[model samples]
Target: MPSNVHSEEEWARLQPHITKLYSDEAKSLKEVMEAMERGYDFHATPRMYKHRLQKWGLDKKYKEKEVIHMSLLKKQREALGKRSIFFVRGKEVDWEQIEKYLHRRPDLKTKIRAGMLKMSSDSFDIVCRSPSPDPILHASNTLQYTDELLRLLDGYYVSSLSECPSGKRVNKVRDYAAAIRCFRRLDQARTMILANMLEPGFLALNKSLDDLKFVVRDQDATLIFYLCDVVTIFDQRHSPLVVELLRHTYGILQITFGESHPLVWLLRRLILLPEIDRYEVIATVVKAAVDKFERPGVDDRVIERLKCHYFLLLDHMASKGIKTTASFPEMDATSMDAVSVAYLGRFADRLVHSCKFEEAERKSDLMLPWLQNTANRQHAAWPDLQLFYLHVKAHGAFTRGDNKVGEAWLATVDQHAGRYFPNM
Candidate 1:
């Protein structure tokens, strides 16, 4: 069948005629459509015309008005579909009715199993209010039952990621992350939480990320690194259960270069996409048209945005008291380029501000040596890179009450001497 696409003028012309036939004369949609085709220049099919009516909000005006007619079956289905896990009936939930409904509609299982469906209240209080046997929902072992729920949830989250189609799973990954965020909140839903039982799979605390690496497709895989990297958000030895859970899932994400740690190696290929571009990898066709030639579009802004993102993550690490190492353990890894060095400089600079005198001094110590190596190789010493190296050292000196050392570095910055900053 041909497209029912009509020009604005044609649609404008047809509207009055359709309104009169359907509402004024009380003709059925099919009768109105037939009249339209016979009298007006309506070339589209009845289904297409009906679709247009719905799209344009015309059908609702002409729809036959009636009372709020919610039948018994409708009420049953609505209650069943409202929450993922609900009570059966009476004081306790009976699984029989809903279980039968789920048996008939397998699609609900697909959504729930894929982590798209979240639980309403973990547990709800349902009472029949009438004289029915008090069928309260009670488990033999509450702790064990909660553990089983967590395991079941964990299985769904993992399966959801695995089931996502490759090369088209951008939103799925983000949606899964959203699901993870919800799952993360579950630790606080109840006072008594089983830390060990709910962790590793359902909610990883500070475990190895070897399992979920395969689930990450495209740039979203980098989220796994962020999830596992050296994050000092909380001390591994936090006193509370909630803090401990946060500590494990978001590990200490310290930035370092070497194959010994997967950070730099992963960063090498993990394409840095801005939060707005989160779903870009899905496909251009899938998204509404993004003007390629628009001012400061994706191309003009990507690098700087990526730099900002790295700077923020690094700054966060320092603020959280995550220790930044003075040196990387020797290992073969992807060599740093100008761009990567710039990112490192930005990151180390944040450490200088967020850390104490000694810690900042140590960061400068590592940075200067690394920057020197990078500077010699690149033969490009712009002001930003030079400032990063000098500012940290000068701050360290000033904080240590070493006026002479601080003054010497300050003199070099003010004088702009060729030898002091040879590249400048």
Candidate 2:
């Protein structure tokens, strides 16, 4: 195929696609290029395609400052300045903004007449009492209670996994579905939301991503690592949230900045987490990130960690007395190391919870020496683990009517608490 495939006839064909691309009420060049390639089947170097886009007056949409912000309220404000009505679908919705209309004084009369929408404030204060300080709802300028605003964001929590359009469902069958036809493609919206939605567990939300700052510097890679570290420290490796955040971040960054290696690196780290819905989050992230990278790199430690977790999950299932459906590797129960001890501890918990009294107590006995040795060896290190062992041991003994042994265990913990947890 010739590199210069943009012949006169080709240009005529390409022109329609370019016009459609610009007419799209969309943000993000990555999506535009994808639509051009997949939908239009227009093949060319990125530079050539972009040059053609520029020639067709579509380049302006890709520029950060020039691209329209998708928020409709923002547009109206920019056009009409302040003193404009907070409205929705041509209806005046500012219940409080109506208060300005009550005054009939001359100076206020002519100025108020220029208003497009106005409403009266309610004085029906019926002693609205709350047990605690209501913060978010009462915050001025955030009219969350307004019917119009609620119309847009109502029922946002309709489970994204739901497939059927069910009865009395206030939400779209798909989340934020209204934006797809206007702002970006559903897939593109999904990618962006995943990568950048500043959920609570993610890093500080205040970080600047304007002008593609985060995507350009590959900052989402740092976030992935940070999130992975958090989930590890908190022993939330199997947490769905961690996986969701990673999955979304990877997707969003994939389109925003194509072939991002750092994003893939974080994704591999994420897939290793024990709590992730493996078939969903792992498969999704891996497929998307792999598509972007020619040679997706996998860390050796990540693989090892995954294997350990795989067996750990199996061991856990066995402890619960659930039939192991697969031939899974088992951790040796005889080992006194932390990992093995953890397995023993979980086994004890399962037995106890299932009302297997003697079996649970026996596992506790089996764990005692390992716990004592570990606490004595490095009392300063992993104090939480040590405390957990001691507390469980004492609780187990007390339950079995061995008060003397339980008291001794408590004395040991108190001694350690004074040394290690001085604040307590």
Clash count, one per candidate: 13, 8
lDDT for position 220 in model 2 = 22
User: TM-scores for all candidates?
Assistant: 0.24, 0.28
- Runs in model 2 deviating more than 4 A are 1-308, 314-323, 326-335, 350-357, 374-376, 379-384, 394-415
Model 2, range 1-424, lDDT digits (tens) per residue? 5254667688776665555455444435676667767776766677776676565544332211111111222323322211223333344343332232222122333333343233333322112111231122223323322322222111211221123245322121111111111111111222222333322112122121122233223232112222232222211322333343445455555565465344444343444433423222322332232232222353332332233333334433343243334332244444445533444554554455445668767765665675566443563224544554565566566656789998998899788768765654
Per-candidate RMSD, Å? 20.7, 24.3
Q: lDDT tens digits, residues 1-424, model 1? A: 5356688788767776775576546688778867877786477777766776665544322111110111122233322222122322233434353443344335554554344454343333332222222122333433343343334333423443336566543222121232222212221121112222332222232222322232222334224323322222222233233223322232322222223233322222112222122112112211111121223423323333233333344344443343333232221114433333344444444455444665555544544544566444344443334554565566556556788998998776556535543532
Where does candidate 2 have its weakest 10-residue lDDT segment? 175-184
lDDT of model number 1: 0.38
